[model samples]
Target: MITPDLSGKEFKLFQDFILENSGIFLDINREDSLRISLFSRITAKGFRDYYEYYSFLRYDALGEEEFKELLSLITINETYFFRNPSHFKFLKEYILTPLISERALYGKGIKIWSAGCSTGEEPYSMAITILEVFGFYKNLNIEILATDVSLKALDKAKKGIYSLHSLKLIDEKIKNKYFVPVDKNRFKLKDKVKEIVKFEYFNLIKEPYPLIEMGGWDIIFCRNVTIYFKIESIIRVIHNFYNSLKNDGYFFIGYAETLQQISSEFLPFKWNDIFIYKKEMRDLSLEEKDVNEKETGITEKKIERKSFNKAILSRGLYSKAMKFFEQKDFSQALRKVREVLEIDPQMAEAHFLAGKIHADSHRFVEAVESCQWAIQLVPLFLAAHFFLGVVYDKMGQPQEAINEFRKVIYIDGDFGLAYFNIARIYQLQGEDEKSLKEYTNAIKIFQKSSSEKALEFSEEITSELLIQTCRQNIERIKGFINKKNE
Candidate 1:
């Protein structure tokens, strides 16, 4: 069974199909990966190409079975027990105690919905943590509904089998007590632990609460899963979760999944360095809303008639600086940047621009200082860190440059320049293997961004141009590696 390289059109069609059915956004860079997986299916069916395979899956009766196979390939079930222990720690110390007291007062059991509970580790882990913290599970009724879109994953989850990697973060005492060793490097969850979590095939985006009785849950653990969706789909899914929660009930999300950026339906509360959202309190009077907003730092004066003229002026100055910088007029750019800094001293972008202008004029010392200031103002500013790396690289500090590049990637994993520049640095240092790896990473990331039609970080740089350039660099590096070997 020969697996053909997928054409751009074919990849886009397949991407749309998957996203329409399940709210998973397969980035364009996954074309190669998808083609390989599709090949396995195509080979099994003796299909000629992806088009035929897609047709069969769309029209044929047995397409349902084939889709399950395809879904198992596409869906990333990369969760392990206690992956983010901070979340669990917050739940145990802050949430569970209140829940216990609240449940006692109400004479009711607590319900937890682990939306996208891939392979049961998360839900089961939650069950174990709860049992440990509560000290006697029999007294309190806790219903854990673990749901996933993939039937294959749900099946695996119900069996409760996991390898050593899944158990790596689990404490030895917890492991010995809650999980029994099944085979070498394999463990099966104890029945007592498994009984609490009921696994079901569920879709968060399309499916409304179809099966479960809507008794309202104390908490909903829908972490990490939302990252697979686009921002719009993410908003829809988060809204669905909002409706599912009881009033004032807590909703736990993974740190990586930025629901805050997508939706404002849930009220965010900081718990032990973990941000959990709650259903907005019902029937808050106007006064109460004002008080609530103020506590959250959105005060009356801060929100009402705030002067944007200064902000507008700062943006104008920044724009002028950028124009000058682009036109290779470093002195003029420096003047504009200074004007922006004078107006808004803490403007990270202005500081970053100043650094870039300084770098242009070979003022490495001033460049480094400006970049440091930018970083101090906004530590997670990707461009600032990236330029700082560039400044360091020019200043004969490879290690510092690499560190800043790494920091950029740490803040934003999708940053293409960081990957590409790091790869270039590695190539310069004769680290062929590392260079190739970073180059490949940059190519993959750029491919995805190209497919998305917008570049991340730099508004001016299109993903297509970046991808093409990265590809050329990759080829050059590869040729060099081959030549070096010869």
Candidate 2:
């Protein structure tokens, strides 16, 4: 009889299969979860051994259905009603208000897409946003298309049922108006809101985006969705999103995600505590064509951002200082940065570089102060944020570090280094699933920059580092599970 202890070879094959089919790029870290999920599949299929099941999946006509089920079982669908209140707040206060007010004048349709609408909460939440903003605009053609790859999830989405636990955080007024009690513990969505949203199954990696058929949506919420794929996958998906939006359409993402790595086709816009993107109209002229062609072929480049500037330092002195610092001479480096700063107090780059050195030396408090000063001088500088995040991480303040990293991506999405650090934090927090997603985001950007050298290094490191971490953790978790059984 076969058991769920997948062999190293079989596991690798299964991981590759997931990547090829779903663009989800799994590592050994997910092995325990995959084993559990896959065990259910095997047992349901009446398979005894791992090899037999593997062969069956490879040769059987039912493999595709089973594979889809595997994705459904392993995919993280931890969404709640009106989660991340800021995005919806922005939509209601800024986006929906303005769009509906404008539509009132033009008598046009309003369309939105919740691109990765897990369990239907996001789309339903968005529908509520429209209702709240427009109030009596029942005359307006307001439509929301909610899509996900899991048929099981989509099925639930269509039903629009939520447990009382999921509704606990919702405002009573919003809940009462939008959902009516169906039974002791169940609630059905009011017909008014139900008619506005249509749930459909979509694979961001495979199936054609249904948003195309729905026409140019006025807004799209694809937050935290792209953090799960390789660089090519991100590029493909982002471009598809760009194509699906109307001119000046808005895109919303998780606060932790940004379009800095994706493209400049979207312009950053901020509202009261909420951030979103507006699609910039493309210039299709020949000059624009040249730029486009250059962009199309331009590979992802390794970031070589200097956290600190050297111009403030006397060239000879700076070189000498760097040599000392490289030799682990923190005192000398600190003195050199001070000397340079005394000569040019506003030298943002120099302060940042000093912060980097301090951060590397584990002088986190000094690093934070220096980075904060550098940012004060040059707010758009990415080095300051990166250094600040590192300092926060060293101090064991992960949320602070996460905020700093989020700022880095906000200014520069293509910052593969920041993504790597963010992934590390998530991993350390026992959020391997989230870490895997972030690692994939970094990989996608590295791939796009066609940064073969850096990409090779990352692939080598993550394949060893993250894969091993996952395996070890999974083993630990399984041990605990087994002990519980006993």
Which one is best on TM-score?
1
- Output the number of the lDDT-best candidate: 1
Prediction 2 global C-alpha lDDT: 0.71
- What lDDT does each candidate get? 0.77, 0.71
> RMSD in angstroms, all models?
21.4, 23.9
User: Where does candidate 1 clash, by residue pair?
Assistant: none
Alpha-carbon RMSD, candidate 2? 23.9
How many pairs collide in each candidate, listed in order? 0, 16
**Residue lDDT tens for model 1, 184-296:** 99999877678888887777767566433564777899988978887888888887777778876778888776665777777665545677776765666789778878688
lDDT of residue 38 for candidate 2: 81
* Model 2 C-alpha lDDT per residue in residues 22-93, reported as the tens digit of each score: 777667788888889888878888888777777766788987777778778877777878888978866774
